[model samples]
Target: MIASVAFRNFKALRETSLILAPFNLVIGPNGSGKTSLIQAMVQLRALARLPLRELMPDDERHPEGAEITFRFQPPFDGLEASLSCVSESLCDFLQVTPLSTGGGVDDWVGLRARLLSLKSYRFNHEAIASTSALKDGGELAPDGVNLAAVLFTLRNTNPNIFECFKAELLRIQPEYDEITLIEQADHTIALGLRLAEGAEVVPSDNLAQGTLYLLAILALAFDPEPPAIVCIEEIDRGIHPRLLREIRDLLYRLSYPASTGDTRPSVQVVATTHSPYLLDLFRDHPEEVVITEKHGRTAHFTRLSDRADLAALLEDGSLGDLWFSGILGGVPDEQ
Candidate 1:
């Protein structure tokens, strides 16, 4: 799991450091640099697969360029990269030259691959419903285009994890009891949802947006071999306010193990949300909430628990209430 992240000269994040938890919720108003922070991490992770120059080119317009550091848990060493020079260091052992030098040292390939395994969910309903078979050993696509194929593979290979996914899905939406896959003539499989024990199956294309999103999330959360971290943007976009709690619970369960025989690997979740309902879900657990505020060209990150004023205000009101009233600092300033 990622313990902390620090970035400088990365888009709106001029200089900021944030201590992350197993499950993190980033709440801020529009253009407050929430997405920028996620993009910075995603870009750093992409370095493992792409050259640094292509990801973060040296442009005179932004002389400072960008640098990011990720500190992970035990067994995996920390990594820091200079996007401007494309230099990288793993702990204190090795240092690599610029990207021009065959993309730095290759000793950190394993660590880089783990970081690159980080998944970002950008739900595409039409794509999620696609019946095309993906290559063997393929993982879930970012847009969820290959969701059916991936789930099919899981159902066939790791039935236990797939069953856990179905159980979690039922918890999120009690209407669905089972998930089925329909084989098409072209050898592709389409996802089918059984409403009840013997109810008529609903095709993936016919499923609700919220249902599809929840399925996609559950699949990632319960995968036999889960990613080190997952970044989700606008997590509450299609879901209803009442169901946000369930979604929050699902995320919490994925981040930490429960005593109910959930042996799946713990997967960290970093999600961005504009929904007050979602913010309220983290009221008691303020440490997991990171509030972002943009001032001019720089973005600042602060944990809700780190702010004494916010804590005091919470004595009389909820976190969402404080944020909506602009006491939390992420709201728009009305001059």
Candidate 2:
């Protein structure tokens, strides 16, 4: 798992570092750099897949150069690299030339796969419902457009994981008893929701937006071979406030392997949300909550647990209440 991430000269993140947990919920007002932070992680993953030159941003503000440092949990070495508009290079400690062979080359390859597996999901119901079969590896697209296809593959290859996914999904939508993949005569595949002992089957296209979003979220959360890291933007977008606690519990269970006794690697979840209900659910685990604030043009990140004063205030009220009251820094300035 990623222990921490440090950024320098990366858009709104002029200089910032965030210590991550198994499950993190980032809360911030508009344009406070919540999206920018997530985008930086996504860009790092892109660098792992594409050429560094292609991934680097063409910004002249950071003349000295930009750098992103990723610190991983033990047994795996950390990575630090210099990035620039025209060139990019890895730190000497890596012991490998950019995209070349060396002592740390194998480690780099492994890290690359881990980084590349960092999937970001932003619900797009129509795109998700229209998905066809995945080419291979059952990888869902960043926008979750291939959600149905990926879940279909999981149902066929890893029935147990699919069952777990179904159970979790049911908690979100108790009306659906089972989920099945329907293959059309055109060879395109779609997800079917079986209701009331399979009396009726609702096709993917016919499902509600919230249902589709929940399916895609649970699929990523419970996949047998889940991505190393999953970034979710506005996790509470379409869901009701009352169900936020259930979703939060499901995410907590998925974030740790020991919780589910699953042999597969644990999936780390980093999500951003504006929902006070969602923030309230994470009150007991302040360490997993990150608050983003913008000072001048730079974005700063801090875990809620790191603030002693804030922890003291939680004794009197909920985190959401404190956040909304402007005691927390993520609240928007009236100006």
RMSD for each of the candidates: 5.6, 4.8
lDDT of 2 at 53: 38
- Model 1, 150-263: lDDT tens per residue? 888888899887887888788778787788875667768789888875698888889998888877777776677778888888888778889888778777767875634577
Query: What does candidate 2's lDDT look like per residue over 1-335, in tens digits?
Result: 67777867666676788888889999997877788767767767766675443333345334645566666654344444433322222221111133332233346667667888888777788887774854532787766777777887888899887887887787667887878786667656777888866569888889888777777777777777778888889998778888787778667666876775666767789999999889998777889999998876777898888887876798898888888998888877676
Q: Which residue pairs of candidate 2 clash?
A: none
lDDT of 2: 0.73
In angstroms, the error of model 1 at 152 is 1.2
TM-score of 2: 0.85
Q: Worst lDDT window (10 residues) for model 2? A: 87-96
Question: Can you give the TM-score per candidate against the true fold?
Answer: 0.83, 0.85
